[model samples]
Target: MQAVITFRQFSFRYKNQSEPTLKNIHLEIARGEKIWIAGPSGSGKSTLAHCINGLIPFSYGGEMSGQLLLDGQDASGMTIFERSRRIGTILQNPDAQFVGQTVGEDVAFQLENEAAPYDVMKTAVSSALELVGMQAYEAQGPHELSGGQKQQVALAGVLSTQADILLFDEPLANLDPASGAKAMRLIDEIHRNQGKTVILIEHRVEDVLLEHIDRVVVMNEGEIAAIGTPDELLAAGILPRYGLRQPLYLEALSHAGLPLSGFTDLSHPESLKPTEDGSEPQGPPILSESQLRDRLEAWSTSVLPAGRGSLGEPLLELRGVSFAYEPGMNAVADVTLTVRSGETVALLGSNGAGKSTLSGLITGLHKPGSGEICLRGEVINGWSIRRRGEEIGYVMQHPHHMLTQHMVRDEIRIGLVARGVPEPEREQRTEEALQICGLYPYRNWPVSALSFGQKKRLSIAAILALQPKLMILDEPTAGQDYRHYTEFMEFINRLSGEGMAFLFITHDMHLALEYADRAAVMSEGRVIAEDAVARILADGGITSRANLRETSLARFARAQGLVSPSRFVEAFIAAEKKVKRA
Candidate 1:
């Protein structure tokens, strides 16, 4: 195990920054090793990756100190191209990296830039696509692919460069559960068969742990906090302390008064076992195995059925709606749904499953080819996008897309000013929106200075100023950390409690489980099922068909031979809510 990357007391400060983004970092990554660099947002994980990929002092023009060695050579002397020749970076958004219309052409772009011959470029493109198992999609347009296919194409483009080290930044941020698991498998295959070093910086720790990782490097405030095997880190109980989430099953074990210290391997729920001799657990005077089971059963069976009160009047409804971007292919077809006042509903499916298309029809961005869209029991199919904005505020997945004004205050006020609300009322609503979104302190700050999470809230504040009855949010918590996610989503819950209905188009199962009252699952342009969040997630048939994965808690229940895994899941959710309240 030779060190391919070494950082010896390395630190970097961006221009105009008072402190270094990375502070006295010392780390070593062995060649061909797969490691996860995980932390909450702004913990300096991305900055470390930038340094490795030669973006810090190259593209970003940062002040550097100490040494960064790549393959036993000084990185400071090497140009960006020199470093890029050994490290290929894959961004979070695959759509942002596409330069060619077709997958084959895109993968060949790097070879062409090197002035390689046509035959060489073609062979390289084929080899790369074949490695990612996407050769059949070589001639297809990038937009014609699903989210998983697009990610594969992105990986293929990187592989064509023949870089030995693959750096993935938030690779699973925008993908559904099934696609994300597949992505992890592909990365693992590349690591095993290709013997390439894989460095993944992501917020989705649970998803990345699906494959075997050589080590976990936890970063906090631009410093390496800890580095160890997954079992070691999970046993340390530091992930949640630093605003990152532990796997749901691990959290459940702790909540149930089961000591994790007794188990040497805590990475997977299936690994939990009783002691060889009939004895209580170590490191704490906890319950015996049988007592633990009895305690769990008592707590679980005592939970009341999970449901909400009577629903308010219907706010929005789609009756047999259908739409298509091209002829003879419906993006959304024969779908029907309803959102009542004050309810939070999640629109869920794999990419290309028609979730976003249905939202477009509801918001008047695209008219339905057939059927009716009713708002408050009245058909509003012919309404303009502007008119629909009056009652339905749509938040795009990327917050930057919705931001226009330079300052947060102006961004929230611009929409109100355009709608001709009275000056006094507009002022009041703008302040209310800012306060509601927790953006009042940053109201005068430049939009560019806000973090990704803050920008998301600002976008919501802008839409909130319109006083819309129904808010449609697409991937609302894409890049947010666990802390920011809880804060942001809990705020949304408060609003929902105050009678504002929300339609969440998301791939985040955790968000749906904790915040959403119900989930409407879509598959192949059709509404396959709509029911309680726990039930929808508990159904393996529906989850498999819709490209969703069962929650870890559910899997843990099944592994433990619980009577009703779905009910067990519901009971856990109920207990979590009660804990939050306390």
Candidate 2:
């Protein structure tokens, strides 16, 4: 078989940097093979992906001392356009990759750039969209689509190029469980049907590309730590050593205290089955206060309530709130809600349902044109952004939009200083914030150098340093992996325990089911429904009202005939326990 990609003794140092981002790396990818490259943040996984696509020494200014061959040709001498014909790259940020207003235009942009004939481009674009299950969105504006839809469009655009090798950079990041599963399934189908060579860079490994991957390559600190089958890498126990989280199924098994012998060989289809005895020994409970806290904190800020109360005074209350950008535009309409002290409430809705706008009003980023916003039973209609920051910390949907500082440490300290914290005290608070966000190790690192997920954490860390009474996070886990999500939530739970309320906004139904206590569903800027998470999800009214699909886990549970909530939980726990024993 031809070697689709080959890297030998590859080392790359950025302009003016003393250390290389990728160091002494060696790798080989066979044609028609699907491989997953995984590691913790800042481990050079992205750099390696860039190397394979000829972006390192070609597009990016860097000192390259290595051999990179694409289709048996030296990659260093190829232009980006030349490389694109062989290796189509779907970037982590879908917005950054989009150049056309509509899905059809965007997918055809690349073909047109290559000067393909109109008929050829049209035919290729149609087929690519169909393959990715995005044919219905051909005329839809890319910006108007949901995050997941946009990602699918981006993938279709790449496929339209007819490249032999497809490179995915954290493609699942920011997607809800349902959308993530759909995207993964589409990729699997493409590889199986076309025998395409695929290179995936992602953190969620359990369900993504696991069954389809020919091999798994693990990177750590700018070098390859292990390269082998999924089973081989998992058994070696190198994941935790590199600050990466083990797969959830594996973790579940470990939590149940099951033996590793039964499930360590993940490649074997039989390994996923239950034991012959139909029962596994019970293990000690793995739940910890810290873990619980982390899980709760990780819930999107927009979902949380303003405070804890059985029926106490509302910290933030919206009475008959309604507004829109234009006269006929109704972003939010007749929204009436109250957030008490010490309660976590999640705002659940589809795209353009006014979740973000609702959050903006609560955070004082925008004022309601009608109705009243009350703080502790008092209206604060004209409060300044600074005053609102003192009471509520708002973390935006996009981390890049919120980031202004060049360094991670400085970003954290900026909030403290602005809050009138003394220089010495500000430094101490900044350090604490960094430690909480797991960015302490890279305190001095440039913000530009951080990954999409790390940048999200940094945005939260900066807001956390301010220590507001209510924190509103918009899509907090949008680009995060399972491990980071766990950690981030734990931190939030700790803060909630300290009497800080939160409002979480998100499109992730699984997240809402797992972490949220209270749920609020919105549609067309209206607070149509509100109830407990379980009740809201069970009703199916909210999903239909919001025009969203049921979460993947929920769908899978239903398919398996696990209707009862308790039964589903028991099965999940049992499956998790079974894996731990392997």
lDDT of each: 0.86, 0.74
Model 2 spans with C-alpha error above 4 angstroms? 133-140, 206-211, 229-242, 246-250, 263-271, 275-313, 325-329, 367-370, 382-386, 481-488, 507-515, 521-564, 567-582
Question: Cα deviation of 410 in candidate 1 (Å)?
Answer: 4.1
Q: Per-residue lDDT of 1-582 in model 1, one digit per residue for the tens? A: 899999999998877667887999999999999999988777888889989998877867768999999999999999988998899999877888899989999999888889999998999999999988999989899878877888899999999999999999888877999999999999999999989999998888779888899999998888888888998888888888787998887776666666677554567666565434325544443445566567667767888755685668999999999998999999999999999999999999998899988988999989999999999999999888888888999998778778998988999889888999999999899988888666787788788756566788788788878878999999988777788678767777878888899999999988898888999999999999999888888889999999999987787777676777788778878877877768
Residue 236, candidate 1: C-alpha displacement in angstroms: 2.0
lDDT of 2 by residue, 1-582 (tens): 888889899899888678898999999899999999888777889888887787776767889897988888888788888888888999887998899988999999988987999999999999999987889999989988877888899999889988999999988766654567678888888898988898899876554633567887888879999887776766666666665656533543444344445443443322343223324555333443343223323321213222223433467888998878888887889899987776668988776778988888877777888999888887887888778778988998889888999988999987787678999889888888888777898899899878888999999999988888788888787656556676777778667665677889986554565556588988888888897665566555567777655543343334333334333333343443244335
Highest TM-score: give the candidate number. Answer: 1
lDDT of 2: 0.74
Clashing pairs in 1: none
Candidate with the greatest lDDT versus the true structure: 1
In model 2, the Cα lDDT at residue 70 comes to 84
* Model 2 per-residue lDDT at 34: 90
